[model samples]
Target: MKRPNIVWISTHDINPDLGCYSGVWPGAEYAVTPHLDRLADDGARFDAAFASAPVCAPARSAIMTGCFPTAIGTMHMRTKAVPPPEVRLLPEYFRAAGYYTTNNVFTDFQVEIPPTVFDDCSPDAHWRNRPDADQPFFAAFHGMATHESQLYLGEEAFAAATAHVPAGARHDPAAAPVPPYYPDTAVFRDAIARYADLIAEMDHWVGGILAELEEDGLAEDTIVVFWSDHGRGMPRAKRWACEAGLREPLIVRWPGRIAPGTVVTDLVHTMDLAPTMLAAAGLPMPSHMHGVPLFDAEGTLAQAPNQYTYAGRDRMDEAEDTSRTVRDPRFRYIRNYHPDRSAMQHTQYPDHLATWSELRRLHSEEAKELAQGLRPDLLTPLQRSLVAASRPAEELYDLAADPHETRNLAGDPGHAADLARLRQTLQTWQGRYGDLGLRPEAEILEGWRPGGRAHTTAPPAVVRSPEGLAADCPTLGSSIAWTTDPPAEEQREPSPLERTAGIPVADGRRWHLYTGPVRADASAAWFRAFRLGFEPSPEVAVNIAQGVDDAQ
Candidate 1:
């Protein structure tokens, strides 16, 4: 059997809000994403796909390492966390398996990932740059097609992004549904409709990516996986530990392997993409990875009987919050460590959005009127709870009965048994993985960046030996990378793809993942070491005697 090429497409700040996911969740029916819908019809769409965290950096970190962010100390948003010493990203493993890896490229993993993990890693990187047609490839393309920034508070920005969409393709704000937490207003409805519009734009972008596969005549020989980092970029839906924040749309297209029109409802995390790729490539699953493969031996698209998926949230931007959640087939249980903080803790980042701005203004006006006795409890329970002084320590929601999670049944005696079961499950899961978020930020920060500053990894000492040139760094568990015949500078090309027809050779100057010594006799070799939460070490130049003799 021949190995198949792999193409991964990741979107930003999206959720199960496409036409293919219409029946999976509420408010999803409003999208007009024909490209993704057809892709799902041709391959498989997973209804229970989820992220390990609700934010981009943490969720992306989890997917990269095939481990939950909380377990690997990468749970906080926008903050780099040091992963375990043995952790190698999926691409590095793929490279070791003799696969030409590429990333075109978004590297917000919240951990230091060496550039050598991929042969080409830039906005223009592509599998077409590989050595030959026979060589298997792993190409990943990530972009902000439907990201939160697309909301476009400024009219000029909105017009520039949505100008491509036809009048019929645009969504109707009047028909948008309002969740219980968000007040029914024009602003909320417009935000929902705009999200659907962005989904349409994302579908167009996805079509272009898929067209590339078809254009290269590799669509039938490649496995394409599509998923988003997290959920929609809305108030209480993005950074919170709710169902909307964690659930995502996952579709896999494996020609001749997976059956068409298969809808998988079993729980699968975004982190599982790594193990599935390994299984597809006939590579051994790393013992430290926490994900379960989604494919059986016969390519039946069946999983290893997973009952629940988990997620965590911590230190979102300017606000400090911590929560862990466990979701079964039917219910969701969230345990908030800092119940003293309100669900809407005034995070400065989201406050700038149109939806968030409107929601805050309404909450403020209502609070002012209530405080002066102008209105008596006029706010709905769901709305009031979101703006409460403090959140409940525990929250339980039956997803089937309340898809929107508008009701919390934690204290209800009728649901106490299930709540207790899920709470215990979360505890056991956290303990088993040694949840690093359990420690206060102060203690954890001391280890990552002491004195609120990033440390630098020591330069690797490269020594010539009988085998080759071996490089070792004094910094514990630092990753090392090297390249020969390097490019003149580090800058992107004007085109989206920078491919050379010539085949790759031993001393091509392309970066290599430094697992051991370099046996290839090359001109000049540049080496660097990097670790998460630390500054990358300065480049160490080692000139071979055969070429330049400028060794340092």
Candidate 2:
């Protein structure tokens, strides 16, 4: 069998809101996503795809490494945590199989990519840049135009910008449907419309890449995958583990293999993409990955569909909370570790959205207005209740009956058996994964950075080898470098008379980037090591008393 090329195009902060998945919600007939719709038409669209984490970095980490964010200690947002040295990233496995792998411009991966992982990882990185035209390639292109930060523009400015939206795709703010939890004000409605507009913009970029593949005559031999990092960036979404936060739009186009217009309802996680790609490349799946391949070699759904999909959320920006969710086709169960923290806690990112601001204002004034026998514009009592209510320790929702997750079924007497089953499932998963969320935040941070300080790597140790002095770093995965001179020591003279005495120093200009053993002409040398996101190792001097050759 011939190896197929892989192109993964991932977007940010989008759910299954495209016209193909189901028309855009709340009366908007369709979102402008012709290119994405075409991709769905040309291949399979997964209606039950979900992300393991609600936020970007952690979720991307899960997708790239095929491991749960909690298991890998990357569930916290924007936290730097690398997988153990033994683990290999998705692209690294492809590179080892003689495929050219590239990640274009966006790798907000929680873990650092080892030096050998990619052929190129810059803005210009692309499959076309592969040294051999016939070589199989795996490339990831990230589109960020639809990110939630884009929606932070104030309502007036956002509305003004919508004028540039394609005339055929434009949506009116007045007619836009607001989620039940949000106040139905023009500000909130316009924000939702603007998000749809951003999705359209993301589709434009996807079209460009698809066109490139077709023009290059590689579309037939390539497997193209499109998905989002997580759900829309809004209140009760993004950082929350509800369906609106974890569910994603997943479409895979594998020409001549996957049947066109095929729709898969089997539960699939974002992490499954990596394993699926490895399977397509005919590489053995590593044992460390938590995800299973979604499709068999013959392009059919793999046997024994997953019984439950899981998602987790922890420490999103300034707001700190820990929650885990397990969902089956019909039911979704959430366990909040910190139920005391209100679901509406002031998270930095969501608080800036126009809809969030409007909701807060309405909720605070609703009581006063009702006392005066007045009603706010389109603000329902239920919506205000959502804003004021605190999260429960356990939340159970019958997704089949209430897709919005508005009703809490945990307290319902009739669903006791269902709740117990899902709770046991979540507990078993947590135990098996050694979920760090069970630990205190301070403890987790301490584990990441020993002694509660930025990890300071030890200076490279120098030893004699056949060639010369070989430098080895004590900290695994850190880059090593050697300088003839130790960093300039701070001169603190006890007395002015001692200032004239010369401090022995080697030539600083002789610094060299360390790859392996290098023949050193000098008997003594200085070495240092550093890794991204960690403190630099202190410079140390090594004395070769027996000379480099004799020491060997």
lDDT of 1 by residue, 186-228 (tens): 8889888888887788788889989999999999988999999
Put down candidate 2 lDDT per residue, 116-214, tens digits, no spaces. Answer: 456677678799999899999999999778888887766676555444467677766776667777766777787788888888778888999999999
Q: lDDT per prediction?
A: 0.82, 0.78
Taking the candidates one at a time, how many backbone clashes does each contain?
Answer: 1, 0
User: RMSD per prediction, one decimal?
Assistant: 4.7, 8.1
- Give the residue spans of candidate 1 off by over 4 A: 296-298, 376-378, 450-478, 486-509, 515-521, 530-540, 546-551
Q: Which stretches of candidate 2 lie over 4 Å from their true place?
A: 23-29, 154-165, 370-378, 452-552
lDDT of candidate 1 at residue 275, scale 0 to 100: 86
Give the range where candidate 2 is weakest over 10 consecutive residues by summed lDDT: 497-506
TM-score of predicted structure 1: 0.91
